[model samples]
Every structure is written in C-alpha cells, then in structure tokens.
Target: MASRPGAWRNILRRQPSSPRKTSTISHISLPLEIPVEEETLPYYEPEHYYPVHIGEVYESRYQITGKLGYGAYSTSWLCRDLQVLKVSTSLPKFPTATDREPKIYGHIAKINSTHPGQALIREFYDSFDLQGTDGRHRCLVMQPMHMSLLEMMGLNPRPFDLPLLKMTVTRLLIALDFLHAEAGVIHADLKTDNQKSTAPPPKQIDESRIIYKSRKFGRPDKAKGYGLPSLCDLGESRIGATQESNPFVQPHIYRAPEVMLDMPWGSAADIRNLAGLIWDLFEGEHLFGAVFDARGGHDPFKHFALIVALIGEPPSEFVKRSETTGQCFDTNGNWVAHEDEVIPTVSLDNLEKRLFGQEKQLFIQFMRSMLKWMPEERKTAGQLLEDPWLQ
Candidate 1:
C-alpha cells in the first residue's frame, strides 16, 4: 500500500463549471453568495443576514452590539461590557430576565460556562466562544475594525510595501503563535475575509488641521494616517489538545498540502496556511488555484497540467512515502509500481522557463517547502519567521 505522490490529483478530479445562473433561494434566508464576476470586489453589504439577536445578556456582563461576521457553525459579534459604565454620566440600562437571577440561566449562563482566555482575541480586546448553534451562540466582543484583508487586497491589488507586509504578517504570525503554541488552538478558517483593518484613516483629525502623528509606537494606526490589520473570525477555530471534526476550513486556495491530502494534521498545517497567506500578500493572488477551485470541481487533466506548469513533477521518493501512508492513489493498475513513487527530476531552471525568472524561483521554493505533503517535512513558524524575505 504505497502512497502515490499524484494522489492529490486523483483526489481532486474536476467537474465542468456550473452554469452562470443564480439559485432560486431568496437571499434573505440563505447565505450571501459572492458572484465570481464580483469575486475581487470589496464592499461590506450591511444587509447580510447574521444570527438572530435574541436581546439576551451574555455572561451577565457583555452586551451584544451587532453581528461582526459569520463562520461555518458560529457568528461573531461586537459586544460591550454591561458592568463597565460609560464615561458619560448617563446610567446604562440592563436587560431584565423573567427567571430570578435569570442571569444565572439562559444565554448568560452559556457564556460563563466557557473559558475566558478563549473568549479574548489576541492583542485586541476580544475573545471567542466554542459552543455552536445548539448551545447559546458564541459572542466575541472587541473594538470594531472596518475592512477585511479581502477588502484591503481588493482595494490594493499591487504587492504590499515591505514595511506593511512585514507588519501585517508579523502580527498575524504572533496571533497564530498564540493560538498554536500558547492556547493550543487551530484557526481552521484563516482567510482574507477574517483579517480585518481598523476604521479607515480620518480625512482630517481636527478643525485646525494641525500636524498629526504619522506613526504611533512603531505601528500604523489608521485613525492617524496608517492602516493596521486585525485578525477576526474564530467559529472554525479549535482549542485545547483535542482534535475535533471541522468542515468549515477555508477553500483549497488557502488549504495546506497535508489538508488537501486528507492526512491527519496539526499546528504545522496552520504554519503551511500562514506561508500561503504570505505568498498571497506578495503575489496578490492565490497559489493553489493553479490546481482547482476551493469548492472542488475542475478537470483533473487540466488541474495536473497547471500544477506541472508551476511545480514540475513530484520526486520519486515522495511517491513511495505517500503510498506507504495509505494516501489516496489511482487504483487503476496501469502504473502500479509508479503509483507509490514520484519523479522529482524536474529542475528549477525548467520551472522558471515556464513562469518568470529568479523571483519566481524564490517564490516557488518558499511555497513548495510549506506545501509539502508531509507535515514533518514542512517548515515551522519559527523557521519561517527567520526567512530572509521577511527581513
């Protein structure tokens, strides 16, 4: 039972593209669908339906302000502390419950049941909830940021400046380090839509329009004249040492090679994803799309063709290792011995011959290392943090 290096291709056989027609389901009840034509478009649709606002207090403290974003099984919300009085003299009105110490039961009780560290988002003043729809919906409270990474990239298709890219990736890596190393969590759903930016830079700070600070504390504060990226959305995030089933991971474009191979994965898979995200920041486009769509459905031959164009063929030893792992392989007996082997003789010069030049080689090497089919072969976040590219 040798593992086939091309097993990935067999597992992702493509189907014909769907006809360009909208489904009949009403938009109000169903999830919002971003049409392919507007795929790169960036504008927040306020009317997007989120979870129901049941007018309930959570953990007898945080008050739900509004919906922030939605994930596979949970919805994110902007919340404020009911116990913390506003600077204004006006007293705050708290919600009343029918049951005595109603705070002891209902939504508030559900909130109190979860751990506090999980509740707070890294760096920012926010936290996440694990309970899904069956339990009281998890609410994440934090300072509001305006746009997502998707929106920012959509607005600026060009590669980000070195400073900005470093800052963004550094903050993202820090958050990921906390999730993986410190909190022992995996944000299965990491994407542009989840990384939000603080409110847009103010056109003018004060009536006088006097000189304002250009940079604050070595980081950009968009309110002053710089853009800061924030990571959000944790519904698909897993915590503790347990491996829970999750079907809400980001599409194939952001998925790591191990995830694509359906192999048992861990925090290293997240490091792979972060690597792809950094590539996206540099390339201003997804890398895996060269293979297939995120939702699946594409010609196998065509997908393989694209892969060949980018990464050449897999090495022979790679194939043998995959087959030994019982990974998905073409059952057809035509190439049985080769089934568990990969032919990695293709050279970088050959790859560059197909794409661009030196830069392309650097990018390909970096991506292929992170996208290795084996988790053990993949680079660690700490290793990537020291890459000369980041410096």
Candidate 2:
C-alpha cells in the first residue's frame, strides 16, 4: 500500500523488529504501485510498553520510583540520584521514566557526552522500552514533584485566598520571566496542570508501600492552604526566536486575544494568559465562561458576548482597527460586514454597567485591560505586578 510522502519514510524508519531474530528468515517481495504520498497510512499510536519495573535501574545511576504525569509527548517520573549517598536514601526518587529504557539510556549518554552541564541540570535518570513485554517505545526521566496545581485546586475546599493567589501568580510570572528573559524560551502551555510542587520527605518506607507528606501547606487561617508552586512540562516550550506555533496550546480560555486573532505573538501573550489564570484563581471559575458560547465553537464572538456583558461593546475605533486587520464582526441580524470584516464593538457605559452592576468591577477591569485586542495596548507583566489589586 502507498503512504503519504513523509508518512512512508517515517514508517519505514520506525518499523519495529520481532522479539526473536530468526536464522532463516523468509523474504517476501511486494510491488509498489501507488505513489507513496497518496497512500493511506495507519494512525501512529503511542507505544504502551512500560519496560522498567518499580525497582529497575538504568546506567547504574538514577533509580526509578514511580510515574508522574503525562504530557503531550512525554511522561514524567519520580527518580533518585544514586551518586549522592548521603541524600540518596533520604530523598525520594523523583519522577523518572520506566519506558523505552534503551533509547533513554542513549539520550542520557549523548547528553552527558555533549552538554554535561545541561545534562546535570536535567538530572539524568532512566526509562525503558517494553517492546517484548508490551509494545511502547518512548520514555523520559525528570525531577520528582508532588501534586500539580490542577490537583491542588481540586483538593482545596475553599477558593484560593488573595495572598496565596498572588504568590502563585508571582511565582508563575517569575518562571515565565526566567524562560523569556534568560532562557529565550516560551512555555506555550501554561496552566494549573503543568505547575508542580516540590516533593516532601518520605516517612514510612517499604518495598511496596511508601508514606509521603502532604503537598499542601496550611495557612495561618485553618480554612486556607498553600504550597510552593513550580513550573514544569516543557514539551511545548520553544526558543523565543522560533516562529512556529504549537497546535495544542491550552484551550481558548487561556489563549490571548492576539493568539485568537491569528497574529504574531511573543512572550507578552504568556503574560495575558497568566492574567487570565490569576482571574480564575480569584473568581473560582473561568472568567470567560459566561461570554463563551460552547456551541459556537471557539469563536471570539462567544467571548464578545462576555465583553458586552462586562465592559460593554468595543468602541467603533477598536472595531475599525480590528476590521483593518481582517477581523470579523456580527451585527445581530443584518450583514453589516463580512465575518472577516466585522470588528468588536460596544459602548464604554455598557461595559461599565455590565461589569459594575452589583459585583465589584475592579478586578475584572484589571484583567480586561491586559486582554486588549491590540498587543501594544495590553499591560506588561511588570506593570501588572505593580497593580493595586495584587498589592
């Protein structure tokens, strides 16, 4: 059967061998009639083989403990460093991989040989390929973490307290700053699920049973809880200079308007997303949910309804600018403009009325200001950090 041009090459290169090598293998010849590019290839499924058992060791170094969370392309695990004897037993194994052992070993070796410092930063560990046992072939080794922010959010009975919220947001911003300012990288997917907590010391331990401390740190008030939040999951991360877009960024809720408009966005967009996250922390629900019409797909209009409901319709000038940029707008019934020509429109008083009606609008305004359609008009992370609400 013919396959897509790129698809055929990928398949031919990645074909797996049988478990046992045969001395006398039969050769079967087949004719290629259809063009490779036109052939339909089977969907590529991720290998499910997790080769390394609980106590397995790779390269005689890092030891595997257990699985962490799965990312778009990789699975993290908790592992321990064998070289550090003193802290080795005390420190629980951080998240490390148990799948695709050989490939992971090769990657670690290569990284150690080429970029030793960077490899050290990555904390080399082990993963395995359970081809014979299962069929999966990929794995990863990484630092150990406790509950992710998503887990923490679900675990907390009460909404995030103001100080905790600010602390969390600040830490995230700082992480983003380090990525953008120093590393020249962009964390495309920033969400609660990707934020992890540092692992606490283990208490009771056994071959099969291990006791761990709670990730949550209680606040002065018994009702609230907090933890040190650390950013994780860099699979979608890219160098700042790279111009490609990842297809699987967080949903529209966390997406910046510039991204929604299909415009070229940089690190600033990350700030916008962080702002939305902060709002969610305080509101205890997605800020854009009311405006979003799930049935309409991810159209901005769904959010436009929210804008109208809160800040009123966008101004004609704003609409005109949006139109000039080929943005679409809808005028209730009549066809005022093409979908691409329509721009967001609303009056300021309508916005005030919608947002200020009964509930306090200050925080909402803070978030909206950062979500401006025009990138230049939006507030920066530094500016948002100084906002009175946060203070």
Candidate 3:
C-alpha cells in the first residue's frame, strides 16, 4: 500500500541481539517532511540535551521508542521497558537544578501515606547518571503520562464543563492536603503545565533530534473512571515548613498578595495559586493578567493593582510585615498605584460566569477563603476538601 501523504517514514534499525550479535529488528520512525522547526529543536545543544537515538537501550532495559515532549529544561522520550514490559518516560536530564529535584522527590518518598491524593503526585521511578558530550547527565525514569491541562485547555475551545471542574478541584485539593500535612511539602508552582491528563508513540528520529507530533486529548465527557490528574514536575517545590524568608515564587499572574508584598509565605500561597488556577480554568481568563511597563517589563505594582480591584485592599497588619509594601500600598493600606486610574472596577462576583445565585455565592465564598490578604486567614487544604462548593 502507498504511504499516507503526511504519515511517518519508518526505518528498521539494528538492535543488539546478544553480547556479540546484532539484529535489524527495531523500527524507528522519522517524519517524512520536517517542519521549519520542531518544538524544542531550536534550543537543542550538545551541552544541554543528551543525544538520544531510537532503538538504543539504556540501563539494558529501557529501549528508546519515540519523543514525548520538551520544556526549557528537559526533553522526555517514550521508552519501552523490556524487563517490565511497560512504557515509561525517560528524561535525559535538565541542565539547571539537576540535584534539587532528586532531593525533593526523596523527601516526598519518605512520607508514608495512604492519603488518596498521594497516588496523584508524579515521582521519578529511577534515576542514574549518564555521561554525555557536555558532562554527566542526570537521567530520570518516570511513568508514561498524558498531555498537560494547559495543552488540553488550548485544544478544547469551549468552556470546561462544571462536572469536570468540580472533580478536578476535588482531586487537586486532596493532593495539596497530602503534600501539606503528610509530606510537609508545598508545590510552590501549581500551574496547568505541571498537571497532566495523558501520550502517543513517537513519529520520527533524526541522528541527534527526534521528531514527534504532539497529540491532544479530546474533552472528557461525564464518564466515570476518568484517571486522576497527576501533579508532575517538582523542580520548583519547596520544603513548606522550613521556609523562613519571603522568597519570590509562583508564576507572575498567580502570585499571592503576601508573595507580591514580600511577606513570609507558606502553604497558604499554594491555596491562592490554586484559586487563580481555578479562575483561569473555569472562567477562561486570567484573574490577574501580566501587566507590563513602558519598557515591556513586568510591572508588579500594576499587577497588584488588579489584585486589589478584585479582592479589596491588603489588611494593615499584612502590609506592616513587608518593607517593600510601600511600593504598592500607602501607610493607610490604600493602593498607592493610583487606584482610581490603574485599578479596574471589577469583582469576583461580577467577573464569574456560568453560575448564578447560590452557586456563585458558594464559589465566591470558596474563592475568598483562599484569596485572603492574610496567609493564615486562608483555609487549609483539608478544610477546603469539606467546602460546600466542591461538594
């Protein structure tokens, strides 16, 4: 049969049959027509990424099958584990913060928990050091996963169904509870990219670059047995209980008030982060979109102005904790960034769509619990699990 117009070009590669003999048994696919640029190919360098070849066996068990995805730090490959007869993800290594991730995962592993959310967190299966052209690359083995929530949101144009939203929130809260109470950890970054739903086999491989088409998961129906959303990528996670200083963490738009004002932040920051994520996912808009200055740089004062518009001004005591609070708020706790001009006349009550009356009330109340000016004022993950809105 003639090959399809845009189908993958397949080639049989030689694989080692034994210690001495080799066999042309493994098939490798490369895209028939390469695009002007593949996803992370432009950023690929010998020093940064380990050169992965198709049909190559690592640790004498994982056979590189295809490309999965890539971020700024690492590129993931789909591999068939010969010994276990299961598919797994092989992260060659991230150049930055290579040592920190293993330590964080180690801390998470030590906490023995039967909490339902414990299973939802993605942890590395195995790790080893691989010598590459640049240096030793820290390779991580993880379970094969689906595309991320961000990708799913992009693919599906319509609004998220309420049922799916509720279910996702419930699961996320459970996971957060486990991390906070059981693990004494905080997933400081809780964006959609870290949360994944589901992967396809690889399409092609160059000598150094692997080319694969990314797949999009269709919008899930109100079906039972939807796999729990796994929270992956702990590179930015912090030891929650040990954070003594007010460190700048979290994505720009999702920054909690305390984090923005330079106050000591903890797990409550994650709660605020989750509220912002919920707004983005359900409302189809960012609660606090990135505000830029004249030079096209992030103007946090302008960003905080939007935050003030939605949830009233930061409490006086909250402002007192920060030396940098004067930049955004006055001594009287009023927004110093010209609230009349910069702050928009918006509220969560008015901005929220899809729900009405009591449902909206409950949701706004749910949001308020997390979006407080004071960190301690925010509800804990366990407390949020019992929220009527989620129920």
Candidate 4:
C-alpha cells in the first residue's frame, strides 16, 4: 500500500501490554480504499484507527476478514484461525505492537472457574507478531464477540428492559469483581464498547458494489443466548495499581473525577466509567458528551463543568486535597461555571428522570454508589454485586 506524502504513522508502537481500551464501532465494511480521514470515526483518528483490507493474512495463520473497531491505541480485526479448528472471533488485540494485551489475555485464559460473568470476559486463544509497513506488530486472539453493547442498544433503540438490564449489569459486575479481587487486574476502561456479545456472521455482498471484509467461511456463527457479554481491548488494562500516573485513563465521558483532577486513582476508576456506561446504555447518549474548547477542540474543563452541573461540586475536602483542583475548580469548587454558554449541566436527579422517565430510585441509588466524587468512597465491584438495585 502506498502512503500519501507526509501521512503520519499511527501511534501503534511496542506498548507495555497491560492497559485499558474502549470505544466501539460496528462491524462496518468500508471499501478497502476508503479514506479513513474522510470518514469521521467515533474516536481520535490516525491514533487508533488503522487500515486492514480484504485477503490480508497475518502470522501465516489468522486471516483478516473484517474490522470490528479500534480505539486511541489499536485497531481490531475479525479473523479466521486457520491453524486451529477454524474459529471466527474478534481480536481487538492489535492496538499495540507490544506484549501487554497478550499478557492480560494469557492471564485470563488460565482461569478454571465457571461463572456467568466469566462468559462475558472474552477468552484469549493465542497471539502473534505481524510484519507491517512500520514494524512488527503484536496481535492478540480473543474469543470472538458479536456486537458491542453500543451496537446492541442501537439495534433495540431503547433502554434495556429491567430483566435484561439486570442480567447484563450482574454479569459485568461479577466480571469486574473477578478482575479486581481474584485476578488482581484493573480494566481501566469499562464501557459499552468493551462489553460485547457474539455477533452474527458477515452477510453476503457484491464485491464490486460493496467492500467485503470477511472470508467466505471464516467461522461459524457464534452461538446465541448461551453467549455472555465479555470485555475486550486490553490495550488499557493494567494489573494491581495503575503503573502510570497520568490524568487520562479512559474516554472523556467515562473518565473519573479523580482522573480529571490529576489525582491518583485505582480500580475504582473503572467503576466510575461503568457508572457512565450504564447511563449511556439507557439514555443512548453520553452522560457527558464531547465538550469543545474555544478553538473547537475537545475540552476537559467543559466536561467537568457538566459533571458539577449534574453531580454538584466535589467535596470541599476532596478539592483541597487534590493536586490539580486549582486548574479546574476555584476555592469554592467552580470550574469555569459561567463561561460556557451552552450544553446541559443537568443535575443527577434530573438525569435520572430524563433517562428512566419513571420511578428510578433503585437505578439512581445504584449509579450514586459508583459515581461518587471520591474514588475511595465508590463501591468495589464485589460490593456492587450486592447492591439492592442489582438484586
């Protein structure tokens, strides 16, 4: 493939394997020649999204059939494990040419327990390195999942019914519990994009009119009902405490307040992301959608302004304790409150009514427990499993 002059190579490098990752796109079939720059993807382009065309074979085994999605660090492909009993699974495993994701998959693949949530966490199969134009790239093999919860919500176009919502939340909570308590891992980014179930096989298409992103028989249809939604994209998954000390850990909307404040955070940050994810599931919109700066670029302060509008100010104690609070909040905890003219800074109580449109006491309580301003005060995944709302 020839490159346009001055085209920036993606950020896919030899990253440390264990990290968090999210932001899902549908199993979209684009013309192999379609310009990525022309299409506005959901997340940062060039950084995460990469080009994978039809009939490209990698590691002399797995064949690239389709693109599931990618994030700030990696692009995922649907592949056929030619070496194994042909299995069709999605491997968002190629975001970084490093050992981190493979390491996390290797860790998860060793579990011998049986639990509903276990099914939700995609099983790791294998990995390999591929020769790319830039350099050797690390690719991971995960049990193929169907569509992301984002896609599923789009398919239904409504909040999940109480039963399905409970089931999904319960399973994901259990999975988080396992990752936090048992495996000693932290899925720094937990959102609908990471929560995926098996998707149906690729549909037939005319090669001339449409781009085909799959093999003729890559693998059989992943089973339904018996399937469980699992987390994918370990590019951001980490073990124990976050080895990196940075403000950015997750997508802006799912980002924790502590993260916004440049304060240290832990696994509870994932819980905060989950709180936003659940709300997005029901409302079909981000609790804190993109906030643009004066230059029309992504703005972090605007996001916090919305957070304060909704959840009210962080505890005064928390503000005084934070290292970066001054950047965002005044002594009284106002962060450019009156400067921005537009965008809803709705309260949590209003958000509950707008999202649920009915009695939302249980759901409200459940979100409050996780979305607390103080990361330490938020419930653990295990403790969340016992939430009366979930019950």
Q: Please report the candidate that would top TM-score against the real structure.
A: 3
- Candidates in descending lDDT order: 3, 4, 2, 1
Assess the local accuracy of residue 167 in candidate 2 as a C-alpha lDDT between 0 and 100: 80
lDDT, model 3: 0.68
- The global Cα lDDT (0 to 1) of model 2 is 0.45
Error of 1 at 25 (Å): 28
**Tens-digit lDDT track for model 4 on 251-318?**
77788877766777789999999888888776667777756666766677687777777767787778
lDDT tens per residue, model 3, 1-391: 0111111111111231221112333444645554421344545453555556556676666676555555545556666662211111223453445655656667776665678777877745655555555655556667666567787778778756888898888888988899899888888888886423233444444544444444345656657434567777776788766465554678777877777666667899899999999988899888877466777656777777777888888888888888888877877688776743478788888889789989999999999999988899999999999999988
- Lowest-sum lDDT 10-residue window in model 3: 1-10
Give lDDT per model, in order: 0.43, 0.45, 0.68, 0.60
Error of 3 at 88 (Å): 16
Per-model TM-score versus the true fold: 0.53, 0.57, 0.79, 0.72
What's the candidate order when arranged by decreasing TM-score?
A: 3, 4, 2, 1
Candidate 3 pairs with clashing backbones? 29-204, 30-204, 146-198, 147-198
Superposed model 1: Cα runs more than 4 Å off: 1-67, 79-136, 195-223, 239-248, 290-309, 315-364
Error of 1 at 301 (Å): 6.9
**lDDT (Cα, tens digit) per residue for candidate 1, span 58-121:** 4445554333443222234444542211100111121111111111111122232233332334
